[model samples]
Target: MTTDLLSLKARWADLRQQQPQSRIRDAAQQLGVSEAELLVTGLGETVTRLTGDFRELLKQVTSLGYVMALTRNDVLVHERKGVYEKVSFSNHVGLVLGPDIDLRLFMNRWQWGFAVQENGRKSLQFFDPQGQAVHKMYLTDRSDEIAYNRLVTRFQDSQQSTELAILPAAAKEIEKDDTDIDVSGFRHGWLDMKDTHEFFSLLRQYGVGRQQGLRLAPEGHAQLLSMEVLKRIFAEAADRQVSIMVFVSNPGCIQIHTGPVHKLATMGPWFNVLDPTFNLHLNETRVDQVWLTRKPTTDGIVTGLELFDKDGQNVALIFGERKPGKPELTSWRTLVDDITAAAIS
Candidate 1:
């Protein structure tokens, strides 16, 4: 059984190298062995069958190897050498060496001693695979430098407390599965004016603060100046003859439109704007929704202005198709003269 197991192990290793996707059952069949034997040899007996120190050793080695493998990525030799050189100067540099390379690989190549003789004539040594001393040094009984150096060296050599290794192989896998969305065609604009004094004043009364106008392309724009500004605009529009509709792109674009210019000859502090080739959404119905849904309203007037929290969410709405007959709203140049005339009145 032992000889057969060794032969099967060798055959398994060969098949694993040649046909990476070959299943265990297929490999066992190809080797003229039963699946039961293969399973027993490959995975060992079940945990219930494990007894004594051997079981404990098996558990420890398996767990330890798993942890070590998780962090054992190949680091550039030059980078490691640079770090070691920097650390060596400090008499006590904490470093951890893993199983990827023998101690001689660093000591022999770097010309650094690995073993040390501590106070009380105790000798400390590091060994390679062949049991040869990889490093050696000496320390006097009263030498604090030597003791500190020994502590640092031991700390550096142990693999405990190291973070998981991020391997290039894993990075490549992540890159292969990643995707990016294009948004080059998005555009945006904004409108601001000094003449909206009444609007600004009303905003301050209602706790609506200062504001800045923003526009996203294809007939969407909004004023993000201040929440107080929005409250006052909505409240005044509600009390007066004008009907207001504010639209916002999910990410961070806003658009506001007011209707029925009776008694008001101008566009107040309000402006027409849009974000072109930008990710934004027009919540034209949000104000309508609030009026229909909630009660007593909140602190500010619920203008239909959709507020996007950040730039990323704003991009999504900006990239979608535009609303039809959205008016040539992007042409701010033509509207500016009319807007200015109305605001002054």
Candidate 2:
């Protein structure tokens, strides 16, 4: 190891000794380094760097059946237990249409991967160029350990260096003033949407940030709500049996759950969905803005609750579960309408 890396590893060890319970992600933050950078210090010990076509490696994940897929951003973590099936890629985007482990992957953002074994638990971790984790899969008791071992052995990088090349994050673009935007044209475009997927293209076309777009939404299409409404929404969804889609993403991946959420709880800053196959833990305190948004879809109008953190980063998105050619669920629409009405009243 180089002198710098040796020093870094020593410092990391000392930090761990001081804060034994701190997660690696938090510890890396405390040391002002990326998680992948710190994580590499354990190379050839508990972690193995894997270098190859990640897409090809991902296709083999099915062999390690029934693992726990985890994806998270700054304020929310989404976990689901399932086998990886129906994996497909088109250009830089990939999709895992598995019944339980559904994900939308931005493959181009993925830069590093590792096979990790910590505290007797094994996992495959993937990270962005900035060393931030994009997605992870942990082995459950039911996972095929032999398959995982074989796959890791096949792709382990020959170079086991404890050094990582970190990329600086791109600069943020300053949003234009409201007066500078074509509000009339933007509203028209919002109202003219034919599919929910088109909303993203519409945003790019208008150079509008998500919250900014919400602010400019056509009449009755967007309503500002309070944070407390999140609790009510969960309670109502559970009590009334409303199946919904929960979407949580980082820059690299979007993990989705499309079904009913039950056994909701709030402990400290977290609001949780403790379902059997899927789970979500959200930092309620991190939410700086909550908006009820309605969008035009081919089947009909679609409604959802959007949450954002103080930095205008999306915390999560909750929408009624619906498939193409199917209109928005009347029950879901009524549930949201009633919640909004009650909150406002």
Predicted structure with the largest lDDT when compared to the true one: 2
lDDT of 2 by residue, 108-183 (tens): 9899999999999999999999999999999999999999999999999998767678999988768889998999
Question: Which tens-of-lDDT digit does each residue in 1-345 have in candidate 1?
Answer: 367666777888798899987755467668775433443343222201111221122122211121101100011000011001111111221222222211112321111112222123322223222222222222333334544343434433232211112122112111111123111222111122222223334333333222211222123223323333333343344344343332221111112122322221113332222221111112222221111100011121111233333221221111111222332122222232233334445
Error of 2 at 331 (Å): 1.6
lDDT of 2 at 122: 100
TM-score of every prediction relative to native: 0.17, 0.97
Kindly provide the TM-score of model 1 when superposed on the true structure, using C-alpha atoms: 0.17
lDDT, residue 184, model 2? 95
TM-score of decoy 2: 0.97
